[model samples]
Target: MNKSVLDASALLAYLNEEPGAEAVEKSLAAGSAIGTVNWAEVLSKAMEAGIAPETLAAELEKRGILGNTLDVLPLTIEDSMEIARLRPLTRP
Candidate 1:
């Protein structure tokens, strides 16, 4: 709750109008964040659902839901380093 790092999935859910879209909308209004990486994930899902990228981007921009507008954070060194370290584990 303190970090607000848990809403990207909800954001995607909201875009898809899934079960928790309302909560995601509420979270967005209350100041939640979306990671840059998660933006790709959201876009990917939107594409898979037949949403055109340009249109989707516009929708997100209009809603002021683009990561930068709401709080799009880049990976910190520690996070990237850990992901690098975990790459070997991912191989298997």
Candidate 2:
């Protein structure tokens, strides 16, 4: 089974139909997930684009974005801690 841990950029590409969207779409079709924080990032970007978060969320849900193609998963404690630990490795 093809799978991937999608981040905000990948999701945004798919949503915006940008280049490389097909790769994201493929992962989505095979089922995929995003960290809750990444999920928030996607929603935040949508909101910045004038979409009401609730409205977009509702539509996505209605369209089965959740439970079908993508799963918005809560970050586990280990995941959060790892992110914190890796913070210093990332650019500011």
Candidate 3:
């Protein structure tokens, strides 16, 4: 199975039940991962939304999202380089 690498936007969509959330959920169900940087983005967004980081994490854990559904991946040097390479294409 091809594991999906979820960005902060994707995970945020799923968490907030926003548009495209189903797609994100599908990715999660089929084995997806978020890099540490993206995970931090999610946490930052949560804090901005007035949701305590621990509270949000606990809620995710209760729903079996943290471990069962989504995996957090640490970035390696190669991964950083790849992201940097893709940055230009991803940005206008």
TM-score of every prediction relative to native: 0.67, 0.81, 0.87
lDDT of 1 by residue, 16-50 (tens): 68898897777666666666788678778778989
Task: For residue 34, give model 3's deviation from the true position in Å.
Answer: 0.3
Candidate 3 global Cα RMSD: 1.8
Report per-prediction Cα RMSD to one decimal: 4.4, 2.7, 1.8
Candidate number of the best TM-score: 3
What would you estimate as the lDDT of candidate 2? 0.86
Which 10 consecutive residues of model 3 have the lowest summed lDDT? 1-10
Question: What value does the lDDT take at residue 41 in candidate 3?
Answer: 97
Better of 2 and 3 by lDDT: 3
What is the C-alpha lDDT profile of model 3 across 19-85, one tens digit per residue? 9999998988888888899999999999999999999889988988787778888999998899799
Per-model CA lDDT versus the true structure: 0.71, 0.86, 0.89
For residues 1-92, write the lDDT of model 2, one tens digit per residue.
32788999998998899998999888888889898899899889999999988887787778777667788889989988999999999968
TM-score-wise, the better of 2 and 3 is: 3
Point to the candidate with the largest lDDT.
3
Candidate 1 TM-score over all chains jointly: 0.67
Q: How far is candidate 1 from the true structure (C-alpha RMSD, Å)?
A: 4.4
